[model samples]
Target: MKIVNFVGYSGSGKTTLIEKLIPIFCAQGLRVAAIKNAHHNFDMDKPGKDSYRYRRAGASQVIVRNADRWAMFSETPQGAPHLSELIAHLDPADLIVVEGFKSEDSDALRLEVFREIGRGEPPICQSDESICAVVSDKAREAFSALPVLDISSPEKVAAWITEKLQIKGIEKC
Candidate 1:
């Protein structure tokens, strides 16, 4: 499986871009999975729910399921797991899109989303060697060495990803 990490500032539209790309990949018949890094103390299960109660009752892992789907919530008291560790838990897929973990030391390919929202900080791709491209609201000329993709065109981004990664989906035939 191939993996690409979308690294950018909080408001760089990483989530929005990923949301748009998922369906495109799916249409191409490629399985896509996403991993997002949430801030500390974030909770997925509602309080007073059975899953919540199990977690609160000292269960290290909780699996909640219904006819439609199932999710497993595992407690990691030792702090956040490494990207590789988290990836291992997911079922196999054609591509894995990771959000956040910009500072992670993994060798995974990174695509930096850049937007000029008055944030003085420079794009991480400027200093990060792992970044393969820049998806931005600006024009292509704004970037120096790396390829600059239009953020408004997610289809183009999706096409670029498949081409760059050499990932082909099922044949339409």
Candidate 2:
């Protein structure tokens, strides 16, 4: 499966872009899967619930499924597994848009878009060579060797991703 990561500051519109692009990819008859990384503590199963109680007691992983939704809960007692290990659970898709995992070195094609003026350039991906493009709103000059994309059109961004991954987009007639 082809993996593309979108890296940027908090308000740099990563999620928004992904939201717009997902439908576009689906329209092209390509299966799309996305993974987002959150920094703070997150709780999928709410407190005071059966699953929550089980997890709180001492369960490493808990999965509860219903007619409508299927969810899994996992706590890393040892440590977090690497990206590829986690991604293995996902079904095969044409593309996987990863929101974070910037620190993890997976064979994902990285697209590091930045704000360029205020926040300055993002730290170079030192430990990983997965960065295939450095997209920016204005810092294109500094990263002269990388491909730059406008922050406006999700189509352009999606097109770039599809092109890079050798995935074809259905033409809109």
Candidate 3:
């Protein structure tokens, strides 16, 4: 599967851009998967739930299932796993859009979502050579030949990605 990672600072519109792009890809019938790297501790299950109880009882991994969908929770005592390790658990897909994990090493195309929030912080792309492009609210003149794309237009962004990755949908969604 083709993979792309979107990285940026807080409030840089990374999530918002991804939210817009998913539907465009879906309309073309491509199977898309997303992975988000959370910086804080999070819980998907609540107390008193069977799956939560089972996990509390020390099950290394717990899977809660129903006809519509299923979710698996693994206890990561060793801390968070790498991107590739997490990807291994995913079902097959034509494309995977990863959110965050900016500094992690991967073969996936890294696109930095940049918005001048006036924080006075520079873009990560300046130092991260892995970043292939920049999607920004600003124009191409803002970047120094790093392939700046219009952030307001997700359709163009999606088209650029499909072209770069050579991705095509075989079926209609």
Candidate 4:
């Protein structure tokens, strides 16, 4: 499967852009999967719930399932797992969109999302060669060397991704 990463500072619209792109890709008959890296402690299970209780009871892994969906929660007290290891657990898909994990190196294509009003930090592309494009609300003077896309238009972004990956049968919307 092909992979792409969307990296940006907090509130830079990375997750919002991904949410918009998922349906567009799916509408084009492509199977899309996503992996989001939570930098802080997160809980999918609630206290007093069986899954949560199991985890509290020292279960290394707890799976909660219903008719509609299922989720497996695993503890990683040692450390976070590698990107490759996380990818291995997902079912096969046409593309995988990874959010965060900015420091991990891989062959996955990278798109740096930026909002002029969000943060003042330098762009990730300035220091990282893996970034192939920048999607932003306004043109960034520093990123003139790379392709810049309008943040309001997810279709254009999706089209560019398809073209870059040479994905077939997806006509530009």
By TM-score, is 2 or 3 better? 3
lDDT leaderboard ranking: 3, 4, 1, 2
Assess every candidate by TM-score.
0.94, 0.87, 0.94, 0.95
| RMSD (CA, Å), each prediction | 1.6, 2.4, 1.6, 1.9
Which pairs of residues collide in model 2? none
Candidate 3 versus truth, CA RMSD in Å, comes to 1.6
In model 2, what lDDT does residue 17 have?
A: 78
Model 1 alpha-carbon miss at residue 35, Å: 0.6
Cα-lDDT of candidate 2: 0.78
**Which is the winner by TM-score between candidate 1 and candidate 2?**
1
List where candidate 4 sits over 4 angstroms from the true fold.
169-173
Give lDDT for model 3. 0.91
Model 2: worst 10 consecutive residues (lDDT sum): 120-129
- For model 1, residues 12-120, the per-residue Cα lDDT tens digits are 8999999999989988889899999875578889999999999999999999999999999999889889999999999999999999898888766789999987977
The clash number for model 4 is 0
The list of candidate 1 runs beyond 4 A from truth reads: 140-142, 171-173
Give the Cα error of residue 149 in candidate 4, in Å. 1.0
Local distance difference test, per candidate? Answer: 0.89, 0.78, 0.91, 0.91
Over 4 Å off in model 3, which ranges?
A: 140-142, 171-173
The CA lDDT at 153 in model 3 is 94
Model 2 over residues 77-129: C-alpha lDDT tens digits?
78777888878989898889899877777778898766644666453533345
Per-residue lDDT over 66-135 for candidate 4, one digit per residue giving the tens place of the 0 to 100 score:
9999999999999999999999999999999999999999889899998765357898889998898999
